[model samples]
Target: MKRGYTAKELSGKTGMPSTVRGVKARAARENWPGQRRSHSKAIEYSLDALPTETQIAIITAQSQSRSDFSDNKQCFPAKGKSPPFAATTLNDDQRLTMGARLSFVLEIERMTAEMTQKKAIATIVALSKEHRLDLFLHDRLVVANDRSTPTSTLSERTLKRWISTYREHGEVGLAPGRRRKNLTMPLWSTDFLRCYQRPTKPSVEASYMEFCEKYTSDQPSIHQVRRFLDKLSPEARNIGRHTAQQLKALQPFRRRTTKDLMPCDVFTADGHKFDAEIINPRTGKPYRPEATTVIDVATRKVVGISIGESESSIAVIDALRNAVQHGMFALLYVDNGSGFVNDTVREIVERLGGTLTHALPYNSQARGLIERAHKTIWVNAAKKLTSYIGADMDRQAGAKAFRISRKQIRENGGTTLIPSFETFMAGIEYEIETYNNAPHRGLTKVRDPITGKRRHLSPNEAWARAISTGWQAIIAPSDVLNDVMRPQVIRPTRRGEISWAGNKYFLDNLRDFHGADVRISYDLRDASKVWVRNLSGELIGEAHLDGNASPYMPKSMVEQAYRKREHGQIRRTLEKLRMLSDKNNHMSIVEHSSAPILDAARLAEAKRVAKALIDSEPTPFTLPPDPIAKYQLWQKLNADICNSLPLTKDEALWHSSYQTNMEFAAMRRMFEHIES
Candidate 1:
């Protein structure tokens, strides 16, 4: 039975009468279900307080007793709408409760609510009938599976509308019928046709989006555009993994073909980093020093190589010299490493009369020929080299130890060791020679591509060509063949003495200098030798075997000097300097004018006086009257002649032959007659 309200609520609603007899008791007296306390109150105070509606509502609630509504479930379906498909029963809670995990339920239920009540039910029914429906992405359902879902399909229209709604009101569109879609306007038939005509490739889709962003001030949403594109063709759907791989594989992938490459025309030298280590005799340790090499393109050979502690200019020079042992080169290709870009390397190349060219930074393909050759060294020789257990210099040191140990074994035990620099160098030489001589599969010369016989060249042959070609090219004169290739060494002097190899010469008596200035004539081809001469054409010394030559000075520096001296430009420069010095009073000269002046004004006047003196007849030094006095005496007589005298060669020659001779003869006769 319904529980009756207490007196407090009864008094508040009805009046004192209703409070006295509890609303339930009043209801009973009023012929109501005294079960409804409110009905009793309404009758008790019909005029001032309780209304008829209030009484009716209270009685109605009380009439349906708690026993009659024993079950908590209501008559309406649990969540307002029935589940899709046949009536089903699952004791799952649709509404949220305290302490419940609501994340999954809220998301799924929200998705379900977003669907049109009819369409949402239809999707649920479809999903129930066909458990394999995979297109219920987020809140949208896939209508048709097999027959291409045309853009006209309601589901497509619904999705397009839903996306529009989502953009306008955010995720609120996912909360059932609160969504509104964009209005679709008719586009021109031509534009519609052109849109579908686009290539169905995914790249095209990406490029189209990129184009839109670039050309259109307002870019459309990519998700919407992608869905729109989905209606175009089956090919626009997606690309398969196998298809992508096939496209990538279709491109030629064989190591770049360098068949047309020839020897000496292009050469590459680089420092190769190695994974393994070699023995160093000096420190008794093993280290993997850089392997610097210069290879010939035509011969496919390692022309010059220097396995040094580092790739230094000296090392590069040494390697180049080795390559050019047989011939000179026209062009040298290299990378942009510090060792390659430095002045030292540039000087070396320029001095040798060779032009150095650099590959694009990070572009190894430009030097593919030599780069390919280096691969063999790693694969064939390096891989075979027993792992070096000691420091880079260990082999030499160990060898020494072995030698000493051998001797020690003879005397005492086999524990003695000898670590020396010479020993290490020798061991290095041995290893290098063995590796170079070992035949390589790639290096072996087979029949020429044209001849189609056995290989035509070997690595050694290529190497030999590197030296030979470089030598031949470099041996010519720089003017004729422009061979400026050479190396230089700097040597100190004792008393203004410079040495090359061993012998020393004094610069005091050198022909090119009065005292200590030693003039060296550089050789273009063989830069190692320079001629030393003095200012008086006397050879103070020949630099062939001189130890005074400086090795520190670059070959290019020496070559420049040689070239300048060869063309006599150096002498010209010196003369110009001297003239400038004299003009500035840094040098002194004797004054030839009648008077010398120190002041600027007086100096100008003195110059005019000197000019007048020069124009006058030369005076006899001994007994004749002073030229100035004689000029005063003869002024009248000579004035006319002086005025008419010619200044040019032709005019002077004409007067000297006839007119001047006649005048002089007449003067001589007149003087004779006067004297007589």
Candidate 2:
């Protein structure tokens, strides 16, 4: 940056005169290319014009000077104060001023080695103007000097003042008053703040309108208000503009660290509805299944997971119960879902000597880890399935797949693409296992044992690492776990059975407690059985749906309704066949099975044998299911007209005759009303 050096600075260089006047005399005698200094008689000689040996010495000295300037860390503090870098007992701004000036002193001292302070100051001003200082490149010097203007150059007057102050107070004298105090706060600062800092975050123009309305007499101009408001600290300016909850995203939050936590020190659980459709085990229909997952927050390892029809408190517990089988967590943090905030989860957490902490209501951000896990594990896997119905899937292709699946089911053809629940679950299990074994980004990084490349620890590896420490998890006893995991609800035992989730559970012993209000608790899965408890927490007995019922009987009203729908569908199909057979209803479908005419003698012998067999062995007979019952089934299934099974020929004639009688017509209308 330096074009040249003063006579005194150049004098001590190798092969140059030792005295300032000697160097000046030599410069004049050699006809050196030099320029006169501003406000001084001394001359600055050009380095290129100087002798080659002198030039090399000067350049080498300059290089060392600048290096030392950057490395200088000495702080000249006030009397009786110990020297410390930044932790000294000085005011914060005072330390920064000292630090900046100490660095400045180093550069100035090197320049003033054999020269006066004035000469050194002139050199610094020249170098800074040419953008020569390392600090000048990035505005470090300007920022230290507290300059906010567009210009990068420092003025001579400012340089003079800094030198004078340093002479008087040593290093501490460099701590000047900050320039921020120049801008003045308006008297209506409070009112302006109130108007501008609103939750709606109205623009300055809109807020100015409100301010004008509030203070009609002495309101400042919009520009004036904006200038003063710009001077306000960011924290103050943003206070009311963002609600506490809204500010959380922008605010700095303390992280809950996992380094001090063991494998099961904390756990979080959530349910995610899989994006893919799988065969609904019961109905054989395409449906999305919800996966309830429990994860060890410390290791980011999934300890338990269960995929079911829908998300429920039962699902939450079932996942947690699986988690406890490995190790009980010390704490539980989850969103404020009904499944998590219930007394059941609370009781279980307490039983494990831990605490259940629900996040703020409606705060989805609280489930961040689990939600991300769902994307990495479940969602990515769902995208691989043919039955996937995720939003991102191609619309035409997804619709085609959906239609194909349903068509196959409707036609009684086995599905070709949509996976059965069991197969889909097996795929899900593989995904989970892979997730656990694969490296997780949140885990601590380590050198790969085989490759020697850095990689994050896998969930399983992290878990094992935590186990290697002295920490150990408190395992829950099986009996205690079984007792606590069963979430209890009060239900009345009715007619030797208890109804739950639209399913009836019966046991012979339950009949004694009929019509009694009993506490019922059961596993989320296996709804076929429920444990009956008295109000006092006494275990009464376990009731099962299979009790006293036919092996194939519908155990629930849901199944009963399904059966009714099935029969109605069959009737409609039969009616369509009957129409195609014969409109007169003379040709019965059973007639196709009748034996053809045999030879006369053989037919007579067969008839005689059949008669004897029928006499000897009385056979069970069942009336044909109403094949003709569907004549009116389709028309009036949901119609406003009267609903009835098809009437036989003789019955139709009787019905017509009865309709003529006034009393019969009135009665018939009553029946029709009931049917409708």
Candidate 3:
């Protein structure tokens, strides 16, 4: 019935364009037709350009203006407020709308006492154009309903339905979102979802492509598949994307409640590799050491820590010892890691009168406290070093620092870039101290006396509180701890000594056990001595590394071996150089010079030696041989000259011998003169 109203009148009813300028702007934005009033500069605007919900609000205001809200008491007798429904089922806007609808039904019912329900509604609509209703109900009820819906508005049929819904089901029934109904997943959606629910977590479009691979007629389109997936619960949609163990993260999980726990009640342990590198004591190579840590669950204190080349059995045992020294725990909770599940760790737990419990495999979330502690403590500590090689570390920078450390170790036998063993241990200690003293969010808040503000308790504060409350730690006897923590291994007793860990440890008692298996427990820190026990657990006496092994320290032997090879190489190189120098000296002098070099002593000695050599080899002087032999030789030579038949063998031999004989010197000289 109302065709036009002033901007203020419209805003009062419609709950939009609340200010004068807002009305003008809304009119301009929507191209609303308007006319300037002759009485004032204000404008009167038609409802056609406004949203349907706004139009309905202005009409509803007219209905309320016709009669007092008290006028509705006869048809709906004044009663105490009905019980409040479970309003949580509806969102804020939905809840406001349900209230507005119920109010409208009550107002309509009052008007019904005088006339037909439809005519009563019509009469109120006519009066609202001339008059405004009470500001309170109009603003709270009418405007709230107007603002709730976006373009849609209430109608007589909708009002009638809400009246019935409210009477039967209370406020929750009026909110469409609160209504529950069956949502049957389309059968064909299974095929599309099958492709989508792959481990690769392919996109809807990619999944559609794969779904079309089978070429079935009932296949859903990509958009349809997306719509179906939108209806699927997150867990169902992601079932294939993550393993079952991982899926628990998406589901509800109980926080490991540490509220009731006391200090030393439960100790949770985990291992982390230091991000930065450290020098290995055995070899100078840079490496990341596993920092096995123990944390008191209740106080969140870092009670113990052990760093090693890996989270080995020894490392775990040592970490337990370190933790027990701080406070003996009733239970040791750790993951199913090899280092945690081994017999040595179990033995140590037994000695301390504690239970060893392991978390389920792949469920690290249960040990969230210690795992988080590793990040807060060890991770932060490692980043302080220059050689940090964490994943988030700057790639080029970390690599550069690592190269520097490695190069130093190779050429200088040590490096400052990587932390030294002592420095590393000290840093870990400082970090743990800082961690224990720092405030933790997991702990309950306590008032800070200094600042006069509530703050979370630091681990140290928490531990102290527990201690003061009469909670005490059970300390293991020193001798018992020492015996239990020692690592035991069965090694064959070789020769008259026990050989273990590359060191031959000798014991007088062990000689009788030679060629037999003996259980030996040795301190990792001190390899100098080992305790040998029989297989039956009887003491077999202590053995020392120096006994019958070698006179030198074992480490010194390694150093000596290294130096020995190095010095030998130097000696061989020097020998080669000397040989080369001797030959080179002579050849160089002779080849580079042509001048003759002589000494007077050299020539005189040469002459003296030559004279002695000539005297010693003097010419032979002897009497002549028999004249008959000489004559015979001459006759034979004369006959040989005349005939090739030659002289007889004896005469030929005699003549040859007589000619060569120095004893026939006279005849030889005569023959020589005659031949000449």
In candidate 1, what are the lDDT values of residues 35-152, reduced to their tens digit?
3245344332332234466555445533442222233221112212222222122112211111021221222234554554345435534553555334333212222111235221
TM-score of model 1 (CA atoms): 0.30
Each candidate's TM vs. the true structure? 0.30, 0.50, 0.60
Could you tell me the lDDT of residue 158 within candidate 1? Answer: 38
Instruction: Report the candidate with higher TM-score, 2 versus 3.
Output: 3
Q: What TM-score, to 2 decimals, does candidate 3 have?
A: 0.60
Residue 293, candidate 3: Cα error in Å is 1.7
Model 2 residue 49 lDDT?
Answer: 88
Runs in model 3 deviating more than 4 A are 1-88, 109-119, 128-183, 489-676
Residue 324 displacement (Å), model 3:
1.8
Report the C-alpha displacement of residue 207, candidate 2, in angstroms: 1.9
- On TM-score, the candidate that comes out on top is 3
Global CA lDDT computed for model 3:
0.72
Candidate 2 least-lDDT 10 residues? 622-631
